[model samples]
Target: MPSSISVGREARKANRRLSPRAMFLREFFRRPVMVGSIIPSSNRTIRRVLDRVDWGNVRMFVEYGPGVGTFCQAVLDRLGPDGQYVAIDTNPDFVAYLRDTVRDPRFSVVQGSAEDVESIVADHGHESADYVLSGLPFSTLPPGVGDRIVAATRRVLRQDGAFLVYQFNPNVRNFLTPHFDHIDYEIEWWNVPPAQIWWAWKD
Candidate 1:
């Protein structure tokens, strides 16, 4: 049986009929740098990024800037029974919305910067993440923030874990190059504005 809190949340969600795209646009206008895009990531982009993951071995999957959870359900669908998905974002509205909407035992959303990913993962009872995905606009992040997030992500991932990233700006790869020995990437032209996708392995 569902708890009263969850039941209440569901009722509120039903009453709040705003679509995800509408909510995304509202947030983007408020914080374009943080939200990254006016619309949710294209389906082609999601598939291109997620399909690279070895879902069978993923125990903990961490995502940065999940903006309205465009990748949440897709990750959940492929996640193993015991796998956990932790999404970190600085946007309170997106965090609250995801908490209310994404009802799954394996899903957890945190309202915090990705720079604290190591401690965040620890607090959630995980030693290391098998994968960390980010769609953050590193090129526009406040000076030093992007570096901190990349360094922290490297430390939190297991040896063989991978960091998957998709961004409008390909310069984000420069952030990953120093930390990972091997990175494979390409452009997904099917997206509205097209997106640069990357899979950087910790090796």
Candidate 2:
């Protein structure tokens, strides 16, 4: 049997794993626009988003602004081996961290803008996505950027696909309503700051 000293060393190694919340704070301080939230999303918020996914038929899923991958892991946990999960983030640090940490064959981490969803999906050899989850701070984005992202999301999603977005405020509804045919909204107050989830889809 291993000695107590060796067991203690193994325990310490496990505890050294990087905290996504700490990473979020560090990145937010460096680039508030890119990082968005001061802290990583809570499990409540993540569950709310994941619950909206139609896991049975969802072959391709895209995540916008997946900072430190709070939702990424949840999605991967439920995504099948044949399913494809692509995460796009403009922050290089978050991208690198995700690439190094998330080890799933169905996962791809791209360092790019959410506005490029169409081309990014094409580059990955996927025609369109079944679901697109956005963790971006649309309300805080510059004029027209949020609109462009919403438009791009609409363009890249399949006819039956869904666009799921969680925002600190309801301001993004204006941008989403014009692009999607139907919209459903729900509020989850268990998060660090209460969040509103919007599920939009075309007829």
Number of the top TM-score candidate:
1
Per-residue CA lDDT of model 1 for 29-77, tens digit only, reads 9999787877888888998999988999998999999888899999999
Candidate 2 local lDDT, 98-197, one digit each (tens) = 8778888999999989999999999988899999999888878889999999999998999878899988878888999889879989999998788888
TM-score of 2: 0.89
Judging by lDDT against the true structure, name the best candidate: 1
Give the per-residue Cα lDDT of candidate 2 at 28.
91
Question: Candidate 1 regions off by >4 Å?
Answer: 1-15
The count of backbone overlaps in candidate 1 is 0
